[model samples]
Target: MFSIFSLIFGLLSVVIGILATIFWIWMLIDCLKNEPSVGNDKIIWALVIVFLSYLGAILYYLVRRPERIKQTGQ
Candidate 1:
């Protein structure tokens, strides 16, 4: 039960999990604070992040944040 491959994969999984958690929290905070409450945009993004978690965070980071920052100068 002590295979080297298992150990390596377990460690890798832990690291990835930690990183994903950090990114999630970071994105959540960024959205809450920096994302404008112009209408329902902020609420929708917050919901997306909360419900979708890491995948949501990745989506926001890749899809929306850049454009918002550019448009709003946040």
Candidate 2:
């Protein structure tokens, strides 16, 4: 009953939804386990992921990891 485009969109939605869910879960685990200095930043990224869905989650993983940031002083 579904057209090809419909099927494609359905698949895309499922994949995106799964990816977002997994990313949020991983972010939660990471926050709980680590004492990263940028805790607030990480939490904000996690909220952005949850609220904005797939693209936001992907962006959080790609762009906002605390370990990737440079610290200026000890």
Candidate 3:
């Protein structure tokens, strides 16, 4: 029998996992669509996102993404 707290935590974990998967997919697609400009390397960034998963995606968003945006002026 599962306790209420345990059930809640389990549900939370599942939700978090789903959200993470979605974010990873979104990042992967974005990396694929955008060209490598300046500091960004498209293939390397895609691999990083694939291997590092959530952490890679976050890093790309925080670091490489802004650089690409700046380069494009959009």
Candidate 4:
């Protein structure tokens, strides 16, 4: 029988896994949609996200995401 703590940990692990998978997918799509001027090669970014998984996604978000320009209506 699983202990209470063990069950909680297991549940937490599953949740984390699901969240990570979602994050990875979102990052992959974002990378693909990013313009060339926004970063380096889109293919390379996608590969990195695939191979490194969650960590790669975090890295791309932190390091490679482009800055947004504010539109001033004249």
**Candidate number with greatest lDDT:** 1
From the highest TM-score down, the ranking of the candidates is 1, 3, 4, 2
> Among all windows of ten consecutive residues in candidate 4, which has the lowest summed lDDT?
65-74
lDDT rank, highest first? 1, 3, 4, 2
Alpha-carbon deviation at 32 in model 1, angstroms: 0.1
For candidate 3, write residues 1-74 as lDDT tens digits.
Answer: 56988999999999999999999999888888884644548888999999999999998888878888898753
**Which residue pairs overlap in candidate 2's backbone?**
none
lDDT of 1 by residue, 1-74 (tens): 67998999999999999999999999999999999889998999999999999989999999999999899998
Clashing pairs in 3: none
In model 3, what is the error at residue 62, expressed in angstroms?
A: 0.7
Model 2, 1-74: lDDT tens digits are 56988999999999988876887777655544442555486567656766776667567557655444344221
lDDT, model 2:
0.63
RMSD of each: 1.5, 4.7, 2.5, 4.4
The lDDT for every candidate, in the order shown, is: 0.94, 0.63, 0.86, 0.75
lDDT of 4 at 48: 88
